[model samples]
Target: MRIKRLVQKHPEEKTFWKNDQWFNVYVQVNEEKRPDYKSRLYGEFDRFGFEAEDKYASLAEDDEHNGWRLFRRFKMVLHNNKRLTKDVTVKDFCGKQMTAFPLFVMSIKYLREHLLQAVTTQKIGIEETDILYVLTVPAIWDDNAKRFMRDAAVDADIDPARLKLALEPECASIWCETLGTDVKGAVAIAGSQYMVVDLGGGTADVSVHERKPDGSLKEIMKASGGPWGGIFVDENYMKLLDRLYGEEALTDLRKTEMSDYFDIIREFEHKKRTVDIKNTKHVIVRLSVSLRDLANKYSKQSLEERIAALDSHKNAITPKGKDKLKVDWTVIQSWFKIPIDLLIQHIKTLLAEPKMKRVQTVILVGGFGESQYVQDRIRKEIPDDLKYTYGTNVFQYFDENKYPDDKKVWENGKWQVPFCFKVYVRVNEQVKVDQQMTKRSTPNSKISLTAVYRTTQEHPKYITDPGCELLGTIELENSTDIPFEQQRLETTFMFGDTELFVKTKNKTTGKEAYMTFECFT
Candidate 1:
């Protein structure tokens, strides 16, 4: 009943249909001495909640109770970069140990239930049967790794037929097709060849695609990527923190004061997006109060004293109060250089390949793609002819101009009117009439006619007089074959005819309308 009401409210719903919706599931091991495994669900869901909480919590937990014991990264690396062996064991947040394969299966099951609950609450009528579960893996993952992921999804209660393992870069490429020309820039148009650079927290995946005539895409190059991504940048930042305050102190802070550790990284992530390489100003890095106190207890001097010494050596460290350090722009740039340089080199290798020679655009997508520093570096270092664009820009462009008037038939009334038309009629017979009735007696009473005669003869007209008798009227019926849903009828005036004719055309059923009229005397 609700769906019926929705359809009535939005009569255009009949035009849109989709067989399935896909959700991307990413798995990782929590940060611990023996790390626990966790997973995050992406695509068409509350990504903000995932980012804030850092992990998928139970569906019943309130917002405040979530995100505790959340490990920010994963360490479940496959042996030989392939399948997971039977010996792989990981700890959960409960400190209980389980094999990596089972952990993945459990995480996926949680994600599945959460998504199903969401769909049920929304009353979208999307059952588990309608969903196609797609798990995205780094391009570096081999066939065995893909198989392991597929098996895990099946173990999570997803049908084997419904589960699919997708390469990250390829998935990003497919996503790019849904983006607009503005966000994607000029390169997103059909027939243009481009590469998708998916830079996420843990890995960077790259692949090339050529837009097809039908708006679909075809892969032109094999997927390629590495572990060089946002996580590496975070790692580099952590190394800097280790240098500022003793590494042991930082480690202690991570173990004993994880909330503060998460805060520090969260601040760094915010600054990383706004960091400008062209600006040579001092960038401030805030240290957690707990971290500063721990560093002071373990170091040779107070944290401030060490910062002063570093500043004297042009290391550009300035202690701001007891909890913040002012870092030189050059130092911050150095931290970005490691990951940016690696990403550039990887892109260079991709560009140099024979298959990639024709790539005209480079699309930067995913979490790390939001980094202004990363975007600036790639834009500058890459060849000038090859345009480098971000994923968000593409979506923005399309969102603004999603429905142009020319593409909408209903908006332009293309369906209601005939595309083009011709008129033809045969004269049935001529009858004798009274001479007085034939003559135009009164200017007001005479009907004016405009006619284009096919033969070199004058056209005749009917005269109305007091002596004229009324004849029976004939009405024409609309065609039954026309799809009433897609079209409507209109009355139009024509020249050279006194009779009214009806015509109907079915755009959906491809049925033509025949014009017929009856004459009465």
Candidate 2:
């Protein structure tokens, strides 16, 4: 009936889909503690969510030597490397190797099993069949990446029929619109148009939605945004530390005193949230003695000495007492600048579009969206007017002037419209999963079918047109006993999938054959 928000301790680590509607996931890949911090598909590790993040960060040094790696952000697994197809095969901590697919399977299985157990225990009073599981994914993720998640979910034993995929920002818009009427800024009413910006740890996703008169929401703009999220701010913090302590010292800290290393970032994360335009006071962050001692050991200088020796940040950063650092509000705000600027730039671009002219409200959701600085920056830069597709299969935004009007069939009274098939479809623009059209043609005893062309091209409207290439063919056989006109060759064209299917049958003989052609994205 309604989405139930399951409160969790780690709000920052919670994935968008976990708002309890549908869920989406990303994984951290494990492997060599490479200096580059890029992820790799790993074996023998299944720690998930924020817990996975902490585990991966904690095991940074341990995994390099032992080969045991923990990972997160698995949802973007396909985005990082162009060559990786499905699950990648790599060695685990124990030196035993397997595909990353199993790790995802194991994680989803944990959730699926937990939910089923809850149902069995009466925690949830509903039939197993009544449950519809949704997996949320980024609008930027390619079809392969989305499919990779789908396959993982299917392998996890979540029934495919009950599973659906949602775009991160789109669903956030849905959640915002569905908020109770008593809530402030509640605009779920019909004709309300709003822009939803979902700023997660890895990326800032943007989308626009309008509530239709029928109580359903329609997207007015495609999803767009970039890697301007909380993690980048964290990276900026790390970079600052790298400058102060030197790379060697920070590496040593991560390897030797990992918890202290995590503590430093955690403290900064807290500071990042609290420091804003109104809070002009210097923020205090406690420094572990190990970090101070390590700084001395690695750089032959204490952190205090390093802070005093700084060039530009010299006055802004201060070594307070012995075990703490006092940072000027300006210095702290710089860490948020890059991400906020990037996010604002994107939001501005989306709002500037003519099609987005009617959108009046902007909804903010996601962990990074909690930042007062981020919120302020958006309001300051864009002033008013704020923004902002589907999970991939690379979609090209065709210019309105470039293509002919959408597919239409002249039928009874106004086009008996868009009752076609598809997971997502636009009004006046229908894409069927498998719409079959039957045409009857009289033929003799046999009909020769010569061609099956696999072309990515969508136009030309005929087989004789350019862009068609020969693939394979099949012939249909008929019974000679049937009347000439009655010996019908029934041809059916199915346009439900990425590939086009043609099914043929001989009316008199009951003989059948089919051919498939790949559709160009």
Best by lDDT: 2
Q: On residues 158-224, what C-alpha lDDT tens digit does candidate 2 reach at each position?
A: 8899999998998887676457563225456687778888988887888888888897878888787
- Per-residue lDDT of model 1, residues 141-208, tens digit only: 77777777777788778998888887878888777656885546534567778888998877778888
True-structure lDDT of candidate 1: 0.54
By summed lDDT, which 10 consecutive residues of candidate 1 come out lowest?
386-395
Q: Pick the candidate with the highest TM-score.
A: 2
> How many clashing residue pairs, candidate 1?
4
Once fitted onto the true fold, the runs of candidate 1 whose alpha carbons sit more than 4 angstroms away are: 1-70, 79-83, 90-98, 183-188, 308-314, 386-521
TM-score of each candidate? 0.58, 0.60
Q: Which stretches of candidate 2 lie over 4 Å from their true place?
A: 1-47, 50-68, 72-76, 87-99, 118-125, 178-186, 385-521
What global local distance difference test value does model 2 have? 0.62
